[model samples]
Target: MMKVMVMVKATAGSEAGVMPTNELMEAMGSFNEELVKAGIMESGDGLKPSNEGYRVRFSGSKRSVIQGPFVETNELVAGYWVWNVSSMEEALEWVKKCPNPMFEDSDIEIRPFYSMEDFADVDTSGEFRAQEDALRHTLSLQKASLNNYLFFSGRCEEALNYYVQHVGAKIDLLMRFSDSPEPIPEDMLAAGFEDKVMHCEFTLGGAKVFASDGCNDGTTLSGFSLALTVATAQDAQRVFAALSENGQVTMPLAETFWSPLYGQVTDQFGMAWMVMLPAT
Candidate 1:
């Protein structure tokens, strides 16, 4: 895939700091959602008027700051998006579907970014390419997130409610098998499991957790533990005790080299967890 920078050129109105109307904002928001669903948009944002920005000029290391609203409004960029697209044509097609970005006449410019392969002839030693690859790897890591997804054999709702009562988890979304866009196979679910949670999302503290009543194949949660870090030993003790109710405690909460309090337990639904309070 190739990357492209889509620039929304500044218009006279944009340079004057005209804000988008609510209707226009909604339209753009919907358009952005489409781009995201298509997996083409990497990052995008609108910029404040150039008057609120500044430019630094260098003359043989002698630097001077130039304040804006600079001349040449047509040359200035009001906003931009970094998109990963199959080709320039695909980028153009997506851009065509965008809502009118400006209140008046405006232009959106699509420019392809130069890939590392494009510099093959110049970087004969491969050192610069390696550096670029490392930087990109770091960027990808920065953009990535990790979450725990649990499967409850037909008792997903029960498991979620247990978490709500014990862990103070808040359900964000819940979709039953019947509410699925495509019908789930009948043979996949055991009888009376049709109303079970097909998928659900919830928050424990600040972390998001996913759960589903997957296919009722009697699969059990094992091999991993959710690590819960709290600010105080009292909080850790409270959570550890809550998770231990009607469950097994593998290790009792106590002071260790790493934390003031720490313990491991398997909750009522068979999910394992580690609760700890780091020493201040």
Candidate 2:
């Protein structure tokens, strides 16, 4: 796989100055040692001050020299590292543990380098192609991540079935309230809940939804809604009616130019649902 390059941009927070203190330098050295031992990092180093740098320019045989200490310090890259990893995702996993380079907030940009074979003809066949294909697949899977937000209230497990039936979302994982390894204290367990859904995940189309419930203190969903689009008016109406049976309808299902059927409702737990079906 190609190498991953992590570029760090430094900035001066206060007008006082942009200089690394001795303590900060020591911290960076320790952090770099950790990275080296992890085996993911190949090499890294700090840059010389802009004042010690020079730029060479060529204007059609009229070579010119632009000296150091450019006024535009904000545009400069402070430091960088080259990491040998199988994929960008692997590189990101390593980056998450990277030591904070700045005493204040700074931006880090991660990019993958292209190998020479990426430009080669399709007829090329070798271990290089295999590695490239694997990297591409890994990146594709990372891009497909849903990054869904999870919510829950009492009886979330029961609610999950309703959503799955109407939305065609299958539960990928579930942790029921009763499945906790440690026994919940009697007072806490019997506070006010009958049953809770510890955690549950559902996938509809290419998206994911996660939820849980059954805490002693009741939870309620507010100011949020899930929007769903179906393929046909019949499907939409069927799904909406099912969801509405145990919930309250805010907008009656009806035909519209945008979709053959559309409606909104708040399920029994206070979670809002919106349904849309393609126009016939």
lDDT of 1 by residue, 1-280 (tens): 9999999999999999889999999999999999899988889999988999999999997999999888899999999999999999999999999999999999999999998889989999998998986676555435434456677777788888999999999999998988876667658788887888876889999989867786664656523457666655556666678899999998899875546787879999998877776444
- The sequence of per-residue lDDT tens digits that candidate 2 reaches over residues 43-125 is 78667666677889988989888887666656766789998887888888767776777778777789888774665675365
User: Model-by-model lDDT, in order?
Assistant: 0.83, 0.68
Q: What is the TM-score of candidate 2?
A: 0.38
Clashing pairs in 1: none
Regions of candidate 2 where Cα sits further than 4 Å from its true position = 13-23, 121-280
Winner by lDDT: 1
Query: Candidate 1 at residue 198, lDDT?
Result: 76
Per-candidate Cα RMSD to the true structure, in Å, reads 13.0, 20.2
The runs of at least 3 residues in candidate 1 whose Cα sits more than 4 Å from the true structure, single-residue gaps closed, are 147-163, 171-202, 209-280
